[model samples]
Target: MSAPANDRLFRRWTSRLLLSAILLGVCHPLAAAERPNLVFILTDNHGAWTLGCYGNPDIRTPQIDRLAAEGIRFTRALSSNPVCSPTRATFLTGLLPSQHGVHSFLGGERPSAQMGPDAYCTIREFASLPKILKQAGYVCGLSGKWHLGANLTPQEGFTSWITMPHGATTEFYDAQVIENGAVRKEPKYLTDLWTEHGVRFIEENRDRPFFLYLAYNGPYALGRLLLNPARNRHAEYYADKELLSFPRDTMHPWQFHNKDFLNNPTSIRRVAAEISGVDDGVGEILQVLQRLGLDEKTLVVFAGDQGWMGGQNGLWGMGDHTRPIGAHELMMQIPLIFRHTGRIAAGQTSDLLVSNYDFLPTVLSHLGLSDQRPPQSPGRDFSPVLRGETTPWENVAFYEMENTRAIRTDGWKYVARHPEGPCEVYDMQADPQERFNQFGQPAVTDKQRELAAQLDAFFARYADPQYDLWKDGRSKAGRLGGAAGPAAAPPQRP
Candidate 1:
């Protein structure tokens, strides 16, 4: 059988993105040429591979796809980590998880390091994107998941924080939400509630340069789908679709709770429909920007906090057994779309090897707050790349979560767990699905050794003596079967 016409059409159009320029003629805001308002749309556990623009004909993401058509999209955008909280930290701080230290999902508990006054989650430590932007005459607001630490009060960077008290909730209807310092029960859908708050923030701050860190609890929180009235509202949106029709018949792209991926993956259609709710929110937000004529003066960024694995690489979800830790592609490759009319060229795509680590530095540089960044931050300013400017860029990016460590270059990807165990090496040029692990193959022995050494050296700098996954025996294999807790097993996901 031949491939779909849309895929072929997408390929032809993809070829022209880098070679094309989309010129827009809109009246610039009074403060537009200076500091444009920024709306950062961050989603939880969204996979980059699921979008229609990314060649997934099954999933419907027209709102996000349109952003790609109107602005630059990245072919090689990755999450800093495969989990949630850590990746969010990187986005705010421009530093990797190892440096900033929000390692796993903050589940109603606090890390020992983040205890008491001047904690990292309380908006201390390094200056986050919101802090710097706020200092530079931008009113910053966050209206969604703020899963960095224990206390969920409004932090320093944000002038307004309408957030969820618990990191995550199974609450679909009658959910409790915190606004500024007050808490209330909202009977509306979670996505709509967040969108409502975001739209309000945008409307209130449209007259000036503002920063809205709009995060959503859409498709990622999967367990509550049936309980969620949203399921009834959206299930029929994809009623005609079947799992086999999707790019991979493996699993759902997003799961609400970590355990949602434990069983066979949920229906892809239902998952896509869940995302459609998020799309609806995005559409509403975009409409507001256009209606207020703030579209030209605002920079809209849609990104996933981190990617999730749903039976990719035979790993059922995000935990143990075949899932292991950090061996698959979906967990790291998340969606990233940037749109700013009159500034960034439209319909542009590039394989510039960007990661969540690059988000803050790039935002800083674009907002003219690069000087505020700490000297030791690990991020690079890639605003030029987004503007379609040619600049020397990274070819390899590093990743780590708990006991796992990985490095991916243009040609290959290497993943390994620390303190002795199995390792994976994939020839990315040939097998992007990562079906084969060639780490032990004699043909790639030299390459494996080179990557192994580089991985070790790269992590060596961030290695903490008190808790080093490699040296302190933190890996599941290092613990040698049961009793290592979540870190020791495949059943409980981190």
Candidate 2:
């Protein structure tokens, strides 16, 4: 054999042997060993109430429940904005909708006209979680939905990108996927494909400290999609079981878009099936981590971009499904679980009122990178809670969706609309379901004023001037939808 050919053959064999050694725990880089890896499992439009760990009586989510049991499950984690793109942007940038300017879920199955011919990543200008981690010498990979626009390319600091063609998912099977600049229709289940890609990324990057954004676009029970029966592997399991956890109530007057699917058995089963599918993927991921000996050295965080309501208050979807933009508890709270064995305590649940805006700061703080947190972020560091420390944390969280703004305190919640006449105040302790609006009652007048003032002050301190909708600031995506109320409409930009 020629000398060049012999050298190439020898190099290939050497590379294979080294990879085998690394996988077998025989060798590991010093830098990679010191820095704990990150596995951020982000789900789409899922509510905390759907999981067993969060007290759901009907749905089957044993894997997620095990994760919660083995780590810290936050009981009151919330999203700043109860939509896809806005809350997702908040998670990545630690900025609220007013700061990031993605006021709503980005355009559907196609590129948004607002972004022009050249695709634009909505949060490109901000210091994203992936970007920050990448700068800290960690290789980052994103598998699944990247709904923040420019889904065709790797955005921010992600090097390995496998994402949906666009933000929305019309069908999980035969879905269009963009894998490393190549777009193709994936025949397999989208959820399974996302899991497969995540596993591949982990195995490929085992030698280095990596950040895996294992995003799953599943259990997205909304619109016409919910009208059909689920076809995943778990469909048979949920076929006959009555998912009573999904309330069967009289149609809420505010519900317009998803009224048809309210209390529909097929839709309920579909959602349950999807949730179990995601749970299966979670189980596989955990198994892989254990097999690779990275379970203890990695931090696995599971969270939802926003919350969803399964026929709660007779409402079937998120806040946007309502005319005045609902900020109901079921549409705000999400499951936030963190499992980092040895470093974090197990079998614990925290009641600290936290938001997705606090995610980036807390994760960075947990990894000893709090100094890299964005200056404009209002996110607080709750890493101490993760370490099983009894730290005094404030019991409050804020929410915004275009013209609507809300403040959730320990026992009170006040939702205010821009230049509004129909504001809402609910004594959360007295009425957790938010059925009564005590905004104008003479007895609750002082309490209403106090909560409203606090909400106003929070937005005033955190909201960026250029994107504050209460002050006629524009949304980066486009105009608002389902804004029937007078104050819900954005002011005319002349």
Candidate 2 lands at a TM-score of 0.91
For candidate 2, write residues 1-494 as lDDT tens digits.
22344346435544553454355344444533478999999999999999999999888899999999999999999898888889989999899998888898887424472234767888776778887777666899999988888787888889999998677778789989998687888999999999999999999998788999999999788767887888988888898988899989999998867777898998899999999999999999999999999988899999998999988889988988888788998899999999999998899989999999999999998876776677778999899999989777898999998877888999998887765436888999989999998878899988887887788788789876777777666676755664424435532211
User: Runs in model 1 with CA error above 4 Å?
Assistant: 1-33, 108-123, 224-232, 245-267, 319-323, 462-468, 471-494
Candidate with maximal lDDT? 2
For model 1, how does the per-residue alpha-carbon lDDT over 1-494 read when each residue is reduced to its tens digit? 01243245434433342122111113333332368889999987677767777877766778988888989888888876776677888888777656655556665233322224533453254557876666556788888888775344667568788887666557556888876566788888888888999999999988888999998876663454533233536767567655443334444332324434343335455567777788888988999999999988898999988776544543433422233455467778888888999989999998888888888888777766565564446677889987889888868888877666788888998887644445788999999988777878899988888887777777676543333444443211112121123333331111
What's each prediction's TM-score? 0.82, 0.91
Index of the highest-TM-score prediction: 2
